[model samples]
Target: MKETFEQLGKKGLIDILVVIDDSGSMTEEQKNLSTKMNSLLTSLKDTNWQIGIVTTTVQASDKCILTLVKSTDTDAEAKFAKAVQAGLSGSGNEEGIRQAVNGLKCSQSPWVRADSSVAVLIVSDEDNCSSRGADCPNSPGKTISYLTNYIEQTLAREIGKTAGIYGIFSPTVNSCKTAGNIGYQYEELMTYAAQKSGTTVSKIFGNICDADYSNTLNAISSNIALLLKNQFELSSAPDSGSLKLSVEGSVIPAANYKFSGKTITFNAGKEPANGKVLTAEYNVGAVPLFTKVTLKNTPAADTISVKVGSTVLAASAYTVSGNEITFKTQPASLAKIAVDYRVAAALKNAFQLEKTPIAGSLKVLVDGKAASGMTYDAAANQVVLNPAPLDGLAIELNYNYRTGPQLSYQVAIVQGAKNVKLYDGAKELSYT
Candidate 1:
């Protein structure tokens, strides 16, 4: 799972492009936007912003405004209201997304700022005719993907800039009398903007039929303001080399920010403002111990013991194969477990059988003579000669038994405190 963290910051410079559908049927909506200009202006009065207008028609004179009204202008609200009163005599074939893109391209001079965030408000009651077909036969055939790519690859590519494209159109087919096809392409564009900005589509869209535009406009402006954060805190410490940062939808160059520990601080004059989607992707540096463990040596039969913390575990609690021990159930985080075992090998005075021998199926000899006092230790699965043989004595032991080496392990569980316990066969020891 990815560890994520988010934060909202103060306002920043933004260029607002209001794309209005000036078709014949949009008279009432045009009046609505003009009358509700105060709601939009009041929300952005305190911001370092500018407003521009454009019509969804190919007519050269009806395309876009060359100049932008800055927030600093005393008559900014008046200028914006007048601009939104675009007349209802333009073409019926409304290509809002396409015209919005055109407006940005043709009016980059005084209308679009180099480093400011961009917000596109498409006020329409019709679906976008971005692609070629009956929807808009005379269209440029630019798809929704093309328009969004322009925003990401061209507009947002500027060092810390972002773009939020919102839709003020029909939400569902037949949801409103004048709406056409529910503005499917337009809604898709808004959804894309919301995703790149780390917001929900609901936050970036408004139903064109809404009685009042106050709430929706305010919410959109507020969310756009949050796209201005210059700093963010990560949920966990991340590997420095694994960090990858992106703002809006464009990848930010590594040199654009200073990532240290869990905090990321953008370089001077390089903060984002298009959307609230500033993300830092990285791998966590630390992890917890989970299940299996490896041993230093292979254990001999019947000599295995396991423990977690200070609690001894039964042989049924774990299984050992070669030098790896796998616990039946994973120990809790930070729980200490200890395992001890005797090394398996053929040694001097003792013979540990691979398996249990058949009852009375044994013989013993020392120096070519029948030897006595020999017994089997079931616990160790070993054959022992009582009082061990004299030095240099040729001893022989024969037995009918099964196959593998006799091995055993001891484990202990110790919880609480900051100590680890280990067993060395004869004694239990603790170390901090």
Candidate 2:
């Protein structure tokens, strides 16, 4: 039982290498690196994992140096913890590509076990080596090509018949030529390398300290979990006496479904087989409270009364043939009018406000027509105008508010509001 548990645990282990750029420009990038590493380390600590670190710069004697830490042991973990605490300041003599590839290769030795899968996490500006020498070429394409080929060949030979790789590129160097030339070359090289090695490459820019980094790492972990799940499925045998079926329709028969090993079986109750097509109609739910309801299948000339709670708000009919519902007049109420007019803005923006406040008895006009019971709030920068006795009319805002370079606003017409044209000030932004 102990051996079996160990085997199960071993199958779930994820061996990862973290290759970071320690070049001159990477000094500023170190903050982001530290944050990302800490978050990743914290999240991955509970799992059976190992991490190796490598750095790249032009100052070190060795171009590719590996800082291996035995993750399974306490002493090694402490040592590695110290190294990571030292952060991304260590310098190296080469671009990170070679070192990262070599580090991953080192992890795949025969002693490491053939069943262990390897993944690489590259945090670099992607700058190649810039050692000033007559033999050193300015172009990084050749170096990149060699690294890509080497990684592909190594993974194919060592880890498994099928192996996966993942990479993350920092925004410090994205272009091929710049003040920091390594960034661009690094990106290009890694992109090609990832493609050749069947790896997933992600480019990170802006604030690396944000929750987005954690989210991205979580997504990668989820993907790794999926891969492990697939492996488990492949190792299991299919049950001989079971038939598995997948249904996509809304209606499903009431049956007992069982899964034994790799086979799924469905046992049905004793019910007479009716020749009629089994149908299930699901109401898409209350048309989103204050939002317009554009039915895919419109009703006929005979209108249908739509109610909110016990109050019969408005009755608008549509012509429905097959799966399409085209309504004549867009549905609108005092409470739901704002949702029908705001276009291009997110649903959450309905609550946004400008500086000045528009009081309770606010009014609206569309193309010189009076619209009643309109709601306006200048403090939140929001306005809702709807013509009374709803007849598919357009509403416009003619209020004074300060505009800034970064401030953005959107206006949207209700789903079925006909001949509606929304304008930003006098500029006619959109028509629906």
Candidate 3:
């Protein structure tokens, strides 16, 4: 069977909205964004880029950044320099993004081009206040989902894909707080923003408290450039030496294309013309740098680039098509390929799980009973667990007994000065 390539629509023209937090601590951060705004455009070549700015908090004057410059604009450098600024008085960041989207779309400024790809760049040092009426009361806060829905569905719905969210926020994972500047409950929303595309997909994450945004800007700019260039992943890995790429049935010139693991990136100005049929043929295991497998493309699917052992590879390390998985590099032949991923908490009960031939089988106990309701479909490579496991149950698989993510630190009872026992759940390895 031929490997089918899924081509995404060209995002050559993109409209970007930058939403920043404007509280007192943000004075310095906003200046970095304003002064370094032009640095982001360097990587976005051959792209119809329109830039705008907005604060995460809504202010008294409805301050939203207007379109600064298009890729084709003359003296675009000066225009961008003139329009981008990080204000220090925003107060409604939770619903601020929603407001900005509406405001930008309705503005008379020629910033948002018709039918263009969209990107929401959020920069903040504290957590967001998106409540969306979930448990929190007495405040007009929007839920992360509500904001994501608007960004993906309402704001850029016509683009046929979710707008890219590039964020430089306080670290929600293993958070690091510097001195008096801090946040309390924004990790969930920051995570939601990164995972808004419904995949554990990799997006930009920068420390909002950092003094230098040079690295963040570089990473974000590179990501945007790739998105705008319409880079596509090969359905499977091929030997770099034997690979043949065809566009419109004609083999493309070697100079026109380059290979980064499994993704064949075309140089700017050398992209395959539109309506062209892109295809590649490869030997599955030829000096492989990554592995490939098909997976279910559902919101519940653990369909993002996976971690093998201690390495957390980026999404670029995996080429996931409609329902298959491919890796950018191959692991050791003896090494087990396992990924610990997260699924949406709202998955349907008794739902069948896809991603066939998983590295391990399901070994979860529901309600204190060995889970017997779960069955695997070999043909479909899915798990049929009827009456989905109850919420809040930690369902983990022990495929090949590889060390997965550590849940937490547990205290062990000390029998003597040198005799302490460590345990994982009920399994004790040793005592010394």
Candidate 4:
């Protein structure tokens, strides 16, 4: 089964991406998110919160304003407080959620953690037309459930699994009014997505036109607090039996931990204590390991042994075939090519020069003697001597010639024992 893993058994970051509609009608609503920022921060005061915001204006660089990072004194207050007031002309038909996902792909925030739970918050008063489709005037557009599923599926395909989708929109029919955009058909995706995330429709979806946003903001923050759980998923799957966990300096019993599928969860009372470091140790290597090797002949089954550098490995760990070594399960980490074969005939010439061009400064030596009366076609990159030298005669040609296709890693001299020599035309290369 595919599972997300952490390096050295360490967990990833906790990231939250927010999408705000900057339409003229959303002025007070956008300001509300900033005014209640403290409430959102207070809800997640326990962990490192990576928060970012983007507009639904369909701008090129709408992924985020990185300067608006929370929990830091780096001007996030100014940036986040007045983001919607930046005069970015937003499209009246705002596609906040869709635009947020698109912005994440184009201009990703640096704080986004690979192994973190991602939640997208859309603050809009319109229905979602994020997915490309035909006009919705004649026919009823896709329902909120279909759109929410599409969004989660996209997130799962792009950014691992998602925890929740929190949206603040006019969920009730005709509960709010917008100029020209009458009725509440605008943003039903909010309620649909809230339901898709296992949240009650009334719990996460908020009324867009509410004056005091304490209730809606509280709901959004509560769901975000629940979604942003600190759980480390192993980057590489490990043998469950070989796993051990610890909190601070105390080793925890296996009974305190619940391991199933590709992720491990701590028992209710066994969760990591506050300010305490939780670490795990396990043997991992879910992916097959491939290595380039050289064999004097066909590798014999009886004499095969696995050794990396000077470290002898378990005999049952690996298999050898001709020039390839495959490991059934790799270790916790892999380094550079450390098992290079000392017997490898390295720095050996591979291919012979088929055509060498001659020029004024070009020099040619045949059988260690200077040869003359040669004709060369510089444009064709080919040279011809008055009489071709015999096969046994040593030929040295120096000229500026056009390079050919890249050389392959493996080259075979099928019949000849003579070593091929490669030269830069000015000097010898890896081979002389």
Candidate 5:
């Protein structure tokens, strides 16, 4: 069945709040963002876009980095770059969502337009948890659901406009070297915002580890354009290449429109007449990269989390088959596909003693049973089991040893001695 879209009254009005992490580790990332921000500006040139910058900190006074930069401003690009180059002196615990909500709460700036669509660009290498040690006590919670609600109900509803979230952070289940932690929650919110606002995941998220932001900025720009122009929100995200756009039984040329993940926008002058019915037919599914991925070990259902690049796929996106998972739509070729799950910890057989044991006082027990063939090497002061116990077996060691200062003496013995004689300086002791 073809899905239809009705044009909204608001046109091309977008307020982008860029929330940056100013932690010490974010130095290079900030520079990269500054250098590549122009790409986003160039893409949104046709829209009435305004940019606001804020650091991810609870202190409201110190939050606003750039108050306002409208699309028509002569030096908007430079202003945005300078603002995004938020110095690396802010909190390491980046509560990006909390800062975003606070930004929306700012009454002094008056930058957010009531009718404008909202897009929050979260530039951080950490999760909302502020894992590094910053406390976001003002936030409702550190979960994706709470953050999503803050973005939609608290921010978007307050402005009475459609909203979306974008990110430049780790795009995996686990953190990479550059990022403090994976942007799992931010990414989840990005997917939620994209699906709700008729945009694609790619358009709403970027990788912090990447050296350039050109492509990500372009995607964001295209999505903003979709919001600015008369567009239709598709019921399902479609493979852009397979999408077909038609108006009143007339096929629209590819150049006449742009198909984002779940939305289609007609170029400025190419919009169909008001009364015409626009119809779209497209196969629905993310483009395939690799249909199947084999996991190294069996994964618990509750612990399984899969990510294709920086986009965290919904649980419905893939199905688990044994230890292997098959995605309904494959991931991008170059993009990293990470599958995280819980496995049993490796069995441990050797254990260190708290103190050196008396020559024969050490005893070993495995699973409450006396263990045999166990030996203790005093030099190493550890207990070693010749045959290790099975996985999940508990091991217990019992030993008694002196715990005070230890001393040793070196002495040389003359040629042949019937009985060694020891002396303590003035007093001599004889052994028979």
Candidate 6:
């Protein structure tokens, strides 16, 4: 069978009935009701769904009147739109659910078919029924029982197999019940009826905020989706695997990943292994540079360009032997060594930097004399100037290397001076 709905074809339908409480008790938050109703109707219009509306009112006769509005014609959407605009207006009675359920039970429209999936949504705040007066010739308890039994035995039995009933109670009703107010009687009564009918109930107790609307609507849609999926026995959707890429020892999570028939692309962010490595775990495997590194997009060829700053140190061809690439290069300044690589079919490249080893010691000169008590380390990359008891003291750092000429290297003096005061024999240079 194709699907439950498809197998049954036109015989299957999804009917949603909205029962709104128009009694005086709902006057304070009529705006919220209208907003919620409009949002729900808008979401249902784009789908193959049918909806109906019913309003509850109290009469001078002290009885609950149920008014049903059929929403299945060419003008159904427009009519719902207009009804939501006109708003719900009523007074005298407080039993919205009683009228709603009665009207639903009596509705004879084609959209309310026996096989159609039916969902009745009730919105209310008060709990008393207008149908419970001595002149009405019915006790409140007995009348409520009759209504609950009617729903569970008749409507529920015929449509409950594919039908769902939901209730949204305003916060005012909850507060009243908790405060031991007269409204508590109605709250308890409705709770019983709902429990007996196997209906889902929720409470809305804050301002009509966007978050509240989105969350409530999402919950309703989730329930409907689950119901549809279960009835159709659909297959699970496909899963997308994770993309992997890295630079030297540091890894960059895959970016802008897309899959098309076994072909995947990492389009966003920098590609792994495009930059030089400033620090990394040394490798001793077939590739004696770095090891255990992984990448999602394999390079098209075994060759890649290794660069440091703007200078390309090596352009060699290599092969992925056990997921490692080996290259040869002449050792130069190890301070700023950058590693770069070109991957297969990749638009951009990846790189990393490696730290250089420090060499040489710093010699201190205070007032043209060897300051024997002063000491410094090259790894700290800085020198401290300490003034002695002598006045007019001159401090300097002297170091010699056999690889280069004895040209003066700029030394920064970070004392209580307004500028970086420089001194070369008798020449003094300072920058503010």
Clash counts per candidate, in order, are 28, 33, 23, 7, 2, 21
What does candidate 4's lDDT look like per residue over 322-408, in tens digits? 656666665444543344333333222222446554236566687888866665655565455766664446767775554786554
Candidate 5 lDDT over 22-129, as tens digits, reads: 888888888988877667765565456788888876574534434577877889778888888878888777878767776766666657765556777888988875
lDDT per residue as tens, model 6, 341-368:
4454433211111222234444556667
Q: Which window of 10 residues has the lowest lDDT sum in candidate 4?
A: 131-140
* Per-prediction TM-score to the true structure, in the order listed: 0.49, 0.39, 0.44, 0.53, 0.48, 0.37
lDDT of 6: 0.43
lDDT of 3 by residue, 11-130 (tens): 356677776666666666667666676567657654557777655655444444454656667877665544445455555334444545644564545466444567767666655553
| Residue 56's lDDT in candidate 3 | 64
Model 5, position 159, has a per-residue lDDT of 18
CA displacement after TM-score superposition, residue 334 of candidate 1 (Å): 66
Q: Which of the two, 1 or 2, has more lDDT?
A: 1
The C-alpha lDDT values of all candidates are 0.71, 0.43, 0.57, 0.56, 0.72, 0.43
lDDT value for model 5 = 0.72
Model 2 TM-score on a 0 to 1 scale: 0.39
lDDT of 2 by residue, 1-432 (tens): 000111122133456666666655554445544545434544344345566766654323333345665546667655554444434455534455556566655543422223344555655544455422112364242265544555456554322222334444434433323233334445555455345445454521222223245555555554444223111111233333222322333333435444344322223332112332222122222333223445434333334444444555433444444334344654443343211122222222132344444234344565467655556655556765432323333554444444455244465558887777655799886532
Model 2 lDDT-worst window of ten: 1-10
The candidate maximizing TM-score is 4
State how far residue 103 of model 2 sits from its true place (Å): 1.9
- Model 1, residue 91: distance off in Å is 0.6
